[model samples]
Target chain A: MKQFQYVRPTEAGLAINALLKDSGAKFVAGGTNLLDLMKRGIEAPERLVDINRLPLKEITKNDQGFNIGALTLNSSLAEHKDIRKDLPLLSQALLAGASAQLRNMATVGGNLLQRTRCPYFYDTSMPCNKRLPGSGCGALKGFNRMHAIFGASEHCIAVNPSDMNVALSALDAIVQLSGPKGKRNIPIQDFHRLPGDRPELDSVIGKNELITGISIPTSALKHVHYLKIRDRSSYAFALVSVAAALDLEGTTIRWASLAMGGVAHKPWRLTEVETFLAGQQISAGLFQEAGTLAMRGAKAYEHNEFKLKLAPLSIGHALSIASGLVKA
Target chain B: MAKEKTSKASRRNFLKQSTLITVAAMAPPVALKAAEEQWDERLASAIENVPLNIEVNGSVHQAKIDPRVTLLDFLREHLQLTGTKKGCDYGQCGACTVHVDGQRINSCLSLAVMNDGRKVTTIEGLADGAELHPMQAAFIKHDGLQCGYCTPGQIMSAVACIREGHADSDEEIREFMSGNICRCGAYPNIVAAIREVKGGSKV
Candidate 1:
């Protein structure tokens, strides 16, 4: 790793200013992903503003639901009584993502800002548009079994490798940020961007902004499931994961929220399928139709063509588990 | 005879001067603390070093280190605590697992300066003098290690797993201990060791 200066800022404003002052500076909380990238020489920040001292480690209740501080560790969030009871999907997803040690070190804000695990992006020798703008995409035609199946452009085909982000999208979570302009709340869907011509940019967050917390509104949807399909049963990234939640009135679905991971540049929220499932009776045929509807615009690459078959099956299976028709 | 003696004297001087220069340049400034009361200016000005006040095991260490060194390197290279192994260096393998503020984390992923003011417990601190920790004893009794490269991390993680209440069953122990990879395939034995330790009740 390259030599760099480290600064610990106790206040949010100071941390933001420290990052804004240096164009090559990065705010490091857990250093799980950032340090890994630095070790690989994929990222080299001249200065690191350690924001672990900032007062953003609380999980406070609000009129809406809950506002989780940015520095709240993933393990703490997963084991929180309220989160385990009310937002079990989030807890399950958080636990399902990394190991116990990683969850203990990773923070809520750091998880959202984690980079993709695309092999091309990590290897500096390879030409990746996400790593270096117009360098050319290596995974577009190369071994792309883990490439994006949705919201992908000709420039990039990398997917967001976060299990927590998929659950947040399904829960209607809002990202709270404080920047030079002021404080603002961005919905989870708008926070992460599709890999368009600007594949280098991961999120809509500004260079000077600090993620304060995440605000999740209360929901009537109690039945929830976060189904992560991977090569192994644990400690591996999702191949095609689904975060499903439903508000059921007896056998009929009153409301629903669904999102997918490992198949898109961002959390692919199934709004159309969500709308279709509302007011529909829960049945095998209905869920099968919903699964088909969810795959309306999904496009697959050469190595990931199996996802076309697996994605629909996962959707149906996840919905079945979330609706209590099948045990997860 | 005079010319040969003169060249030999110059060679002796060159050797002495180079040895002194190497020691001044390469060794940590803490090594020179006993020899001089004042800090070395030439060594301090070569590279920027951050002041780190970290509590490791049970002792507090105050030193100036390059900001780039990881907590794993600090423990192994600086503190001379080589019990914690560095497997992948990346967070993928858990050979560098250590407890920071009571929670286990991959030391390789953490910077030493970032751990300022934090209490860290490595494998070296697990045993109490001659007495071994329950987890360490269980590992030996159950033959949980073959190569033993990932033992420290596995034992550390196992201790935290039981404390966190995730070691109730063999399945839970396996899932929680999945982070530490034993390339020799000692997972079944490791799980057996953890189960035996948990059966005793309380970590």
Candidate 2:
């Protein structure tokens, strides 16, 4: 940990002002990810404006749906009565992420603001555009197994490392952000950006802005499921994960939204597959076709060709579970 | 008239008492302001030999500390509470687990001022005076720890897990306890210890 000034502001307004004023200061909420980056010298700030005391820990129901405060811990949101009942996919996704203790301490705001968990990003010796703003990407040619297959630019190849974001995208969750510019609501899909020419722009958020809450519509998808594929059962990020929700009328699918993780720079929506699945009879072959369409635009590195294949399987499994083709 | 006069005196006394209570209630804020003034008087970014008024394990200590010091370091180095191990100080490991305000959290990840005015319960604070916490006793009986570096954190997490109702079975316990990495491979015994409390098994 580097030497820095610290302030514990009970008010969000004051915290934001402090963040905007300081030339090199960052907001600390939960301190799960940022603190780690700081310790490893990946993220350094001259000051830290702590916003943990702000009342951003509520899960309330509005006319639109559920509004979850940004400071709400991941474990609390995972076990929330509304999230568990109304958004089972989100609950399942949150459960699959990290360990119990981290989940207990990690906030929803921090999770949304989480950076890539690429081993290359963690090591400062390596070249990463997200870390260093393009000294050239080391993962492009070396240790590229876990790199993304979709939305990869020449500068960076790492994947978006959030399982919760995948589910939130599937449910069409909206992120509420606050800053010196006041407040704004962004759709979850548009919240995370792709690795375009500028891979450093991971999201449409400014440095001084803080995520205040997330809103998910109270939905009856008929069936919802979250599937995470990884080397281990727990304590590991997903290799290929899918969050799928489907509206089934008898044996045929009516409406569906599918989002895939660990395969793209952001949570990917398989809209082509969703369009194909609507009014089609659910079967293994149809599921395979949908999965195939989901990975149509994927560009794989030398080592991560397996992910291109594994990502489809991840989606197929999630589709089956979500459509009730198989028992949950 | 005498009774009315007595009543007036009693009301005056009650008002004075209320004023005193108000000041007492606002003491922490006032004390915090005074402390701030002292910090400003020194007028140095590098405040050598700064004192940290940390309340830990139901006690307070004004320990001299480096301005760059972490709460975990302050506990392990200043207070000699070695129960909080420093495994993967990057917050990857839960070896530095402690309770700040009745909830389990990673101490290494938090700064000392972040916890000021908040109650801290480290692994050393888990047990009553001379009496081991039920989780600690269960771990000892079940042989849940080997080498024991990660034991304190594991025990603290176990306490939280049970209280959070995550200790339903071995699988659940294993899932919930994934943060506390035990290199000694004492997982089976650790599960047994948690089950002894959650499943109500006789150890």
Candidate 3:
């Protein structure tokens, strides 16, 4: 880890000002991923504006639905009564992530902004376009079992390693930001970006911006499920994970929301599959078709060809669990 | 209240003035030119240490620490509280687990400066004078450790797991305690110990 200046500003405005004043400054909430990156020398920020002192740890509800402060710990959010009762999918997703200790330390906003778990990106010795732009992507041809299968460009093929973001995308969550310009809101689907030519840019957030909170709309899709398949049963990154939410009218599906993780740079929302499943009866055949439609444009790397097969199966399994066709 | 406010204001003023003088004295002409280009980097590298005040266990200590030093190093190296082991030094392994405000966290991934004015309970603070904590006693009774390298972290995480209500069943205990890795394969004994503690069997 490199030496840096630490500033703990009590107000979000002051924190933003500090970040804007220092070009190399970063806003650290939980320091779970940032400190890991720093230890690996993947990131070397000169100034860290600790945003933990800011008043952003509330979890409230209103007509718009739930408003979760950005600094709320993952453990608190996952175990919050309102979240567990109203949004069980998000709770399950949070629980399925890292571990209990990590969940205790990681904040909601920090989890949303976490970097990919690509081995190439962590190794400074390797040529990673995400870590160093213009440097070649080692995962493109090298060992890429964990690379993205969707929304991947020639420059980078890293996948977002967040289970919470997958559930947030399915729940139609909105991210609120505070910066020098003012406050703004971005839908959770648009919060994270695909690996384009500029793989260095992770999200749409400005350099000086600080995430204030996230808002999830009151949803009708009550039957929600988050299923993560990993190498190990726990404490490991997902090979392919799915978040499925369904609204049923009798035997037919009224509405559906679906997203997949560990398959794209961002949570890959299966909108086409959701559209196909609506107005359709819940059955094994329909679930199979939805899974097939979800993987239409997915392209796989050399070592990650198994993901092409595993992704659709996981999607079908998630849909089955969400529709109550199969017990989770 | 007036006295505290005045002292705080004076401290702030003193910090500002001293920082300016140090930057002026240490920064060379070439460094100042580079600082003009990238001020944040130059300004940060110019300073050597940052002020940190934290409460560990029951003791409060104020000191100047390198911003790069992790809480694990601050405990093991500076404070001489080596009970908190550093296994991976990254967030992957939970060998440096500690209780920050009664919640378990990995200290290796947390910077020492980030914990200013926060209460931290490491493995060294788990014992009650000469008496062992219930979890520690259970681990000993069940022979839960082999190499004993990962015991402190495992014990810390186990205590938190029970307190957080995630130790109701064997499977739940296994899932919740997944962060702490014991390479000696004493998992069965460890689970037995946690189950005993969860069942209120202190002996």
lDDT digits (tens) for residues B1-203 of candidate 2: 24534543454455445544554566688847645565333333334334567789989887655445677888898789998999988666789888777777888877776666778889999888898988999999999998999999999889988988898888999988888889999999999999998877654
Tens digits of lDDT, candidate 1, A97-192: 888999998999999998999999999999999998899999989999988889999999999999999999999999999998999999999999
**Candidate 2 accuracy as TM-score:** 0.88
After TM-score superposition, what is the CA distance of residue B137 in candidate 2 from its true location, in Å?
1.9
From the highest DockQ down, the ranking of the candidates is 3, 1, 2
TM-score of chain B of each: 0.77, 0.72, 0.78
Docking class for model 3 is acceptable
On DockQ, the stronger of 2 and 3 is 3
Worst window of 10 by summed lDDT in candidate 3 chain A:
A1-10
How far out, in Å, is residue B74 in model 1? 0.2
lDDT of 3 by residue, A91-184 (tens): 9999999989999989999999999999999999999999989899999999999989999999999999999999999999999999899999
- Candidate 3 regions off by >4 Å? B1-47
Off by over 4 Å in 1: B1-47, B201-203
Better of 2 and 3 by TM-score: 3
